[model samples]
Target: MTETARDRLIVGLDLPTIADAEKIVSTLGNDVSFYKIGYQLVFAGGLEFARDLAKSGKNVFLDMKLLDIDNTVAKGVENIAKMGMSMLTLHAYPKAMKAAVEAAKGSDLCLLGVTVLTSMDEQDVIDAGYEYDPHTLVLRRAEQARAAGMGGIVCSAEESAAVRKIIGPDMALVTPGIRPAGADKGDQKRVMTPSEALKAGSSHLVVARPIVAAAEPLAAARAILAEMNGALAR
Candidate 1:
């Protein structure tokens, strides 16, 4: 039950520029196996930088969280897959989620449906005009994503175990809002320590600030990896 690179960390490239992202990635080196390209990077460099990174033998987690009409999302997903991404993010809407999943089918890519953003809280859910509690809404949307044939979900580690119990083992759980033990919470509202996240059954952990902004990026990554190893040992 040792932790593998595929099962563990996904470093978030939340930098403002491609150069900054590359700087961080170069600093961290191979301590991290996967990197997440969120809206910021996609907006900054379009998809070419992503393609270059993927071609360089790094796993790219494209966290665009695509939410559009089924046809549009399907086409977008197809294009994204063509760029050789390992995973892509989509909202848990049935049509878009299904389209995304269908696009990833028979390809080496995985479509990850976002349940509720880790930056959001209960008030954020209410503000969005959702009547359900944030946790309940996350669970409900996760179920919807699964029913729509998505490969997995993007949720907080807090809800991961419950979702796993509902969705079973075949579906992967990619939990963002992960901080290493004793790290600052920053803007994320629903955060968990790395070990807690893995113990909650997260198939992958998305970490940003703590690793990217650390004084020693590689040491920080290794600290996170050590935590994951402890969880796997348990």
Candidate 2:
């Protein structure tokens, strides 16, 4: 099925509690369909909540950023796939991604290879013991993800266009760190407005604070969706 703008917009439920997540979900209503459950939510009974959302016909992106020995990674992927997750993220390590791809075979789960944290910049990459800068490293990992026969990539929108060229058209390019125009960027160092991210080849845009932190959460979400639709229409 062709994707609508709403379909491409993934709201990050980066809240601290499931109740808070529920409140946001209720507020967003039908205006939002996909959600990302990362560390903050995962520890607070978010796994079951993820299942509930999926059962209710919502797509859940489980942002675990998983990395481990091959067997452990494969085991986790197998269970997460059974949870009806639409997407799962693992650090872009070749061995782990290969194991995850193999384990997720025959499942609907799309394993996303996380290239680098959007909050990190050039100095951060060096601090992490990487010789290459953020942009170059993101592309290198994108290459490995493609070779692993993985489903997609998680990258900053800053690198989406280049990553898209490397991964080609079919793979999902899920971009996080999305900020609307004039919105406070918070801790995210790399961000793009919804339209800019979409035009740069981001297949899915994950937004958090811009929507959830707004006094009117629903309005913020709708506005972002409107911007996304406009970009897509153009």
Candidate 3:
């Protein structure tokens, strides 16, 4: 099936308050259909907000990045599954990933295992006591996630091609750290343009500041979507 621009874009709602989120949604209007509600909004009573989005017929990517004991993560996945979210993210710990897979077995939710934060570099991985490079670690985690029956993986675009090679075409590769041309990288250590990410085999691109923080958010979103569509055309 041919991919639509909307299918390839997942905008992050990293705003602080529900009101701010509502404003962004209102501003972007129909230009955006999928949103990533991460830790900040989730902690600030965003599950109810998520329900609101679902009720309004918009897709939500709940980016809680849950990390806990097997049973705890399973319970969390169970609850998120019931919310009708399009996708949910969790740390790629073996036990947690397996438990989440089991919990989401009969649900429509797609569970994604987060490999590494785009903000972390090789030195940061080394500082964290890992002897391997970031790509090696990401590939290892991607394998583990696939083995555990995760629907996909959250990785930087720089590593998506290697991950696609390892996991094959069916596994969803959702790449974050997407920056448009001339945009700030923020704290993200690994980043790519929208076209670069798509060419690297990203099934979906998660973008935040490049769109949300722009002077004209809708225009910014359209620009990124155009780049994404151009890549798809190629």
| TM-score-sorted candidate list, best first | 2, 3, 1
lDDT string, candidate 1, 1-234, tens digits: 225844568999998999989898899887777899988888898478889989999999999888988889989988888899988988888888877887777888888888999999999999999999889998899889878888888899999999998777888799999987688898899999988988898989998889888888888888888888877788
The lDDT values for all models are 0.86, 0.95, 0.92
Taking all chains together, the TM-score of candidate 1 against the true structure is: 0.96
**Candidate 2 versus the native: TM-score?**
0.98
lDDT (tens digit, per residue) of candidate 3 on 38-146: 9899888899999999989999999989999999999989999999899999999999999999999998898999998899999999999988899999999999998
Each candidate's number of clashing pairs is 0, 0, 0
Q: Pick the candidate with the highest TM-score.
A: 2
Identify the superior model by TM-score, candidate 2 or candidate 3: 2
**Per-prediction TM-score, please?**
0.96, 0.98, 0.97
Residue 163 shift from truth in candidate 2, angstroms: 0.4
Better of 1 and 3 by TM-score: 3
On the 0 to 100 scale, the lDDT of residue 116 in model 2 is: 93
